[model samples]
Target: MAQSPGDGPKRVAIIGSSGGNLHSHGGDDPARLLADIARQLDAAGIELAAVQFVAAQSSMDHASDDTAATLWTLEPAGPAPTAQGSLSEVNETAGEHDERLAQSLRSGEIDGLILVSADPSGTNGKAVAAAAEVRAPASGTGGTSLATAQALGVDLVAGSGTTGTTSATRAVSYVSGLARRWGLKYRPVIGSGPSTVAEGSPWRRISIRGIMVGSIPAFIAMALVLAISKIPGLDFLSPVFDTLMEGLPIVVAAVAARRVSGLGEVGLVAGAVAGILSAQGGILGGLVGGVLAGVLASYLLTWTLAHRFPATTANIVTGGLAGLLGGLVVHFALAPLTSAIGDGVKTGIEALVEFNPLLAGAVAGLVMWPAIIGGVYHAVILPLVLVEMGEKGHSFFGAIDMVGLVMVSLGITLANVVLPRSSGERALAASGAAVNFGFGTFVEAAYPFLFADKRVFAGALLSAAAGGALVGWTGSEATAYLPAFVPPFIATNKLGMALAMVVACACAFAVTALANLHHRRKQRA
Candidate 1:
């Protein structure tokens, strides 16, 4: 369902099937209301695939007159709809308009469905009553939608009650349940469909692993992950994890256990082993132990899922990424590179912890971002590379943390694969990639302003590389895990590394933004 582990994306759609006569909160027509709603949702992180207009009348006059400005991220190929409001008037009957709705549903090309004022009966209370034929189909229609959605195995719902607030609650509840059941952590943000309800969760879409992506496959994968986690054996702290690992040799080539999603248990083992290794022998343990654990887990899990869900371009990509990047290779690799790229920084960090603890701690706090970037890379990207690399090291699943080397190498071969198309997107994507590489986790810190109008994804990388470069130059080192989005683990030479990191991040941000602005100006001309 998702792309490779290192890859992150958000995609969504919005539509209103309410009768054309429905009033906007501010009294604008449905089309105008829709434009405003889509804009608002975009701000909240739900990138709309399209803002469709279904109203009193359907014609080119309404479609051509769409004045809503659209949003274009640094990533998307082209401009996105802002006021892309169109008109779809009453059709002769419900069955006649089935294709229109079906086509609308397909346009989003997403995993879940979001309905605005889903109750057709409530939407055109007066109109349908006036037209006996239209009214005849209303009540029965809602019942049919419920049955069809269930039979099709599609989880569909509206999001408002007062303005359909009940639908909103229902949608959130259903979506959350789906995530829990499947262990698939993905939240497809649907804004203003049932009205502009602010989301309680900080992330619009998040997986069982707590990562976010709006893609359909990603969501399904999340569901699968959640389901797998519940198995008696997959939970790391539980004895089941040990039992499963011990049985790797036997079950390695046989069938999988059923309690958890076939693969979640294996993922848990890999992740848990990686954690244990990191704590045991520092970076070396993390890389080597993690790879061994991951390889073992994959063998067992693969045996289990062999015929059921099987591996895919995406599944292998995400898990393999986690194996290689999150634990060992990068952890150890960075330590060695200190002399060349990050030099005196390490000594400075060490000294701070040893001598000037407070100041050093503050510096560590500052460098915390790189630590997070670096850490997230360990947790995600490495595992993916482990599977994709599929070379001699294929058996060494745990050490796949070494596979993170591949993501960087991809720059030479597949750099353009997930790279931002525009300057803004590049800044965001780059920052995210860099942050993942340097600090260890959470792409959120760099995602904003990435698609914020101009293409800024490239800027993120410029920012990240700068931070990483400084770490290389200063030779700053983190002890435990690179402090994630929160902070770094204690270390010496903290202040120097932190200062270097700051300068690098600043440089990256400046360079990327400048380049993007220049590009945009040229394009406008």
Candidate 2:
């Protein structure tokens, strides 16, 4: 409960404030930084709460394809420069600094706040300064640069406009100093970036224009659309080619991707197609589609190259294909249904925008769960957050727009429910949790309780369906702050909005229990 930064006696969790570092993919400095921080915290006998990191940056013109610079900020839970990262690879992967670490943060559970590696400035410093100058437009130039940054805060500010090493060093100094003045307690770890400072990999950042421009709000508006979509004539998503076609490029590319099992021209072509659709939506959509096409095609190609392609690569490949297909359905079939609902309760639905906290909390809780909650959290909250002050993906609106969360969430939750309590279950839970937490950002806590009994899936699946239906019915926008690479629409309060899920859980529990009992009785007979 110690509130000050660098306070003693607490577990320190290091939060990565930046994205992939393109500089040296061979050497994982950021990951080292995280481990080092964890070691220090553990050594201190204090627990690390959560690490808040921000990788915000800016570019001069929208057209320049050069590296976009970043302002990487890491929040640790102890003293500055107080014994950070290990020099070994054992402490590198993500699991070491998760959950137990994050949970500590949520409850005011930290004893100290340590600042680790707060690097500033980059090649794009000039452009960033220019952007900052015009950040508010009417605000004028009285420290417009600093003022813009101050108001934008660490979460919102990006220091990617620097020209080279010198400016980057200067900017990092200014940022670190300003942060300390603002009480951020960081180590100011300056590194080299042709484009920007990186947390780990250089290729992980997303172009967030679409969701940043109101994806959550837009999708919240769309959630209403989902509700109405349930109405026969109101569903606009059903008959449209967009919803289903959304998955097409991936499907088509899957064929070629699977052919070579490598990130061939087909994969790049898929990426291009997705990029086009995203540009159509704005940077938000572009980032989502582009990332998906890149990752999927790239991964498949890797597998193809290794000559160890999965026999079921087809299923995995089709999953991406299914996304566009689902989109087409939502646009063409389900969309009109929403219109019908809207017509009936247009006034009522419109009046429901009070930003209900209970609903928000529940949705947030769902998002906080292991699978969809934590894994995909990056994708879910990124669009809205812009920074952990910003680290995440799809955001809120991006969440609802993409059908991926649903597919992934269902896979995860169901896996939790259906799998027996064995090493397989444990592995499934781990994978599911990681996917939802690391990649999808959907739900988190539910897995444990649901897994308490196998019958839990019936309730879990039913609840998941209800939640999905609620989202679909409401047309709630989801992709905002984060990028899932596969496109996402989960939100911060996503946990709260998944209310219908309660009933689904109840249904699943009932069905599962009854079936179990029935099987038992038959055995007795």
Candidate 3:
């Protein structure tokens, strides 16, 4: 029965279908699915006002403007109202024309909307905005759709047929519960809230500066560790340095998270959990664990504080519980999962290196450029190289990897110097050159140029690959962790190292120069 608009029960509309065939199941047909959804709504004492079926399409962007067909609309009469046409045309004919579908939502006819799509993109920002405009609560089932809904400040609910029969039933119940709670004002529980800081805002810039400041301690520790390892008879301090390296990740994570969250204690605990996870799983694991821990701690603390408990007792209890839960989960579950993944990666690298060191080195070098840019090489791959170095007393892979990075940085610096766009650019390039040659950390300087010009990046990548391959082919190794660009080759073949560096520098310089020249000519034209 159609419930009156002013009735206590909420009025809702279901849009889209599951976009999957039921395979002779009773719920296979679109009409059946809509009926089932309506029944669910009825059970919850919510009135199902309408069902809008949008034609299935691989890409939502390609869906026809007239694609939506109103299959059913509730009425007090004998038969439900039905309409067949392009959704755009139907809306246009109604004399309430608006360019975006969201404009229709401003009518405030529906109290709640359920968007059921197989994919998230099926329900675009327009639909979400419309829901928001009317202050109508909305929910979605699919991951993409749900994510979109969340990002756009809509409530989320599970959908049917995706997981299993049991899950489908649970999803229905979940939505019903939400329907029961419709009287309450809806606010997104997850994601960045309204009044988000803009990307270029001074606050965001300050956060970036904070991150850089926080990183300095870890950087100094690493450099100290590397320098100490190179000195003869300083091997006794290796464990201390290794401990520093391991602990520094936690400190950095804590400081960064604290700065971002403005929750110092919770951020520290989260960072500690992440550091431990990282030690177990590597960089990627640590990052995941840290983020999870931070969010968990923040939420728990916020929830606890909201109840007006004694401040000291509440903090201790909430903070302790949050840390315990986060630490346990990461240590017991996430650690093992990340460890397994790391093992698989290590196995792959070993197999490839055994098959052909030169090919493996070249491939690794090629891959490293992207990995470095993506910030994965340091977190995941570098640890494996370091482990191999420890086991074998030296690592050909390490030598090639380090040398390739150094050479590429040098190449980028030289490019800027040779083809200065401005006096400021030239000065910046010179500074980068100093860092690359003196400190062996060129990432800060090189990234700007690499991202600015595709041709220059390509040149650097190719050069690095060639250098890596040559180093591997020659079986070069390094006994201690030393800057690839520095003197005193340690246990490595100095001659081979020198040759590889020369080749890498020459290739990088030549390619970058040509690309710069081309760019200049294009500018002139």
Instruction: Assess each prediction's global lDDT (C-alpha) against the native.
Output: 0.32, 0.34, 0.54
Which residue ranges in model 3 land beyond 4 Å of their true spot? 1-224, 245-262, 273-289, 332-334, 367-401, 415-428, 442-458, 474-499, 510-525
Task: List pairs with backbone clashes in candidate 3.
Answer: 66-86, 120-144, 120-145
Model 2 over residues 425-507: C-alpha lDDT tens digits?
Answer: 54555555455544444444335635555555444544444454555444443432132322221333444334333333345
Q: Rank the candidate models, highest lDDT first.
A: 3, 2, 1
Which segments of candidate 2 are over 4 A away from where they belong?
1-170, 173-201, 206-218, 221-443, 462-506, 509-525
Per-model TM values vs. the true structure: 0.23, 0.24, 0.47
Candidate 3 whole-model C-alpha lDDT, 0 to 1: 0.54
lDDT of 3 by residue, 1-525 (tens): 222345677766665443433212222344544544554465456666544544332233444565653433344541233555664554333222112334445555556677665233333445565665555666544444556666666654332333222112222433443454464222112112233213212124224334434554454455456546667888787777666656654554455444443344545655665556455654334444555555555555445434433223334544455545655666777877765664565566567766897887687677767887787766655555544432333455556655677777777778789885444677788888777677656555777777888988898789889987877676565422345454224435667777777787788878877877787788789
Residue-level lDDT of model 1, residues 393-473, one tens digit each, is: 111111111111212212211122243335444444655556555533343444344444333444444444444444444
Superposition error at 379 for model 2 (Å): 6.8
Q: Model 2 scores what on Cα lDDT?
A: 0.34
